[model samples]
Target chain A: MPRTSDGRERLIEAGVELFSQRPYGSIGVAELCTRAGVNKGSFYYFFASKEALALAVIDRHWTWQKGVWAGILDGSGSLLDRLRGLFDATAQMQVDAVTGTGWVAGCLFGNLALEVSSQNEPVRLRLQEIFDEQIAMIASRLASAVESGELQSVADVDGAAKAIVAQLEGLVLFAKVFNDPSQLDALWQNSLALLGLAPARA
Target chain B: MPRTSDGRERLIEAGVELFSQRPYGSIGVAELCTRAGVNKGSFYYFFASKEALALAVIDRHWTWQKGVWAGILDGSGSLLDRLRGLFDATAQMQVDAVTGTGWVAGCLFGNLALEVSSQNEPVRLRLQEIFDEQIAMIASRLASAVESGELQSVADVDGAAKAIVAQLEGLVLFAKVFNDPSQLDALWQNSLALLGLAPARA
Candidate 1:
């Protein structure tokens, strides 16, 4: 639904679903074509190869995810509240994957990051930029929180953001490996500790 | 050097090198056989499938790494000193990988965990047990530290250990993606924060 243009959109959509559900190397171009209802010739017409289609899929998913994160990070409530909202939404996505796919699909960028970063330079660079942006997103929020005098200034807001993002990916790994979404329940508290804050009273 | 036999040891060593250098799905039996200098016939005699060899490789790496960790952890100055020793040794491995192999070979279990958790149940379960063991190893250290009053008792020792492991994995992911081991430099400070302590000064 995000990138639907006759054949091209279909290929991207198929890539997203398949790539998220399993390792990128395990999913073949044939299966992607079949799932998209497009033949090999048409698949070639739209994209050069599976890796090309994969790059497109990464862009498409990041586009959608960035928006979702933006909505939550910019939404109502305090900075901590908004951060928790983002974590909740992330955990919910994994939960939904389990409900719909019978397995924890994990974070798409992270799954690809581990699976293809060394093998594919183009994807690896793109993912690096994406991660930088992800850290920046949170870093920007922390800057705002500091400006407003919400609390004491963090010693290094960017470092805090980077640490927080790393924590997110780390816990996501646990969730995927353990096949349990609740593994992410620690994100909110761990994040507060990283920011040098006490856990919020319930 | 570990689990050394005739063809079997060769295959496991090959698995460690190849699997670390590239994505698991991209590597195949033929190449593995070629690298190990073992023919296809003998390869089957040693392991039933590629996944089987992967399991052997996972066990072998953990066995070796467990010793490295136990040595530093059990022989160090204080609990904090031992923990820092472990983190330093972990980072040094990445640096050594870059020096020896020209790429950061990440934690083998983590690489395999994300690459094959959904497709392979055996590896998933084994990785789950390995992660639990890792968390437990740190929790035991924290418990001893608490008993000595070196620090106040952590509110949740297990939870703190889990968070620290998650942080390590997360930063390792960053180091791998960014292709820079310095991404892990924050591990010590961030880890201290996770354990509800301020950063240790020089």
Candidate 2:
């Protein structure tokens, strides 16, 4: 069992699990407190509102997510192989999560984006910032790919990066819909096509 | 102004608008009734529960949406051109909605899928059915394209179709994030790559 000294950490963990797996608006402060194993007073002491907790959750998730991105994306390998590895790593993570939780929980950021981007502007902008940062990271890698002769030079590297992000996010949604992580396998291969490259020999 | 006679139609319309624009759990039956200009009694008189009304809204949107699909997808032209037209038409529809409603309302089925698929089984299955139907439609068109020598023969037509659906849904989510419909354009061009085809010369 994990120690629960930090009320803020507990709330953010609970927020990530509950908000990621279920609808955001349906989650109440009481249920969140119960899940976190922290009382309402502790919850109030840590955060101003549920929305505030959500921002903290996003920040925490992004910090971990950025590390994952750097490991697969920023490490040494052919760029295409690295991108493919990222998708495989992502699907495996989802599989491991299903083994633990008994449900297919898609990308937390994406699930939230679809659910509340229109309704919540602050959350929406935060999500957009995260997406933009990810896109820029991807764009930089693609630019590197162009330099290394791995991917063909493209006029719009940023545009291609955005497409890759969209496709990966879309594949994650499909995985949730089918309740099977393997759906991601077939879809992610198409990302190569976005870069004008043939599918890697699998 | 559109004339509103039927209580059920009004409820369904309101459901389509409200649920599509916002999170599912946040919108209550009272607000739905108020938006539809029908009293609570009439709401229950027409439907058994909010989920049932969601089903009606899905059915109604699919009905109207199929017409739009037919207009763009069923017309006589190169199948590739038709596919491109569907994307343009979809983006235009989003633009028109933004002009009219001041929000980038995305695909209603997709919005609901992200919000309720994990929480609601029946709704999830219903959405899965709609997605399967759309995939089949696209697969059939792809089959036609293969027959006409427009597209290379592929082993998994259905899988490719699902990728297109996923990409388009993903692009719409990005559009909502940026509150700009143009995010769709860059991402959607990659759909051609899904079919192993180059972009059509415009």
Off by over 4 Å in 1: A1-4, A199-202, B1-4, B199-202
What TM-scores do the predictions have? Answer: 0.96, 0.93
Model 2 chain A lowest lDDT segment of ten: A193-202
Candidate 1 CAPRI category: medium
Interface RMSD in Å per candidate, to 1 decimal? 3.3, 3.3
Candidates' DockQ values? 0.52, 0.49
| Best candidate according to DockQ | 1
Put down candidate 1 lDDT per residue, B91-123, tens digits, no spaces: 999999989877777788888888898899999
Best by TM-score: 1
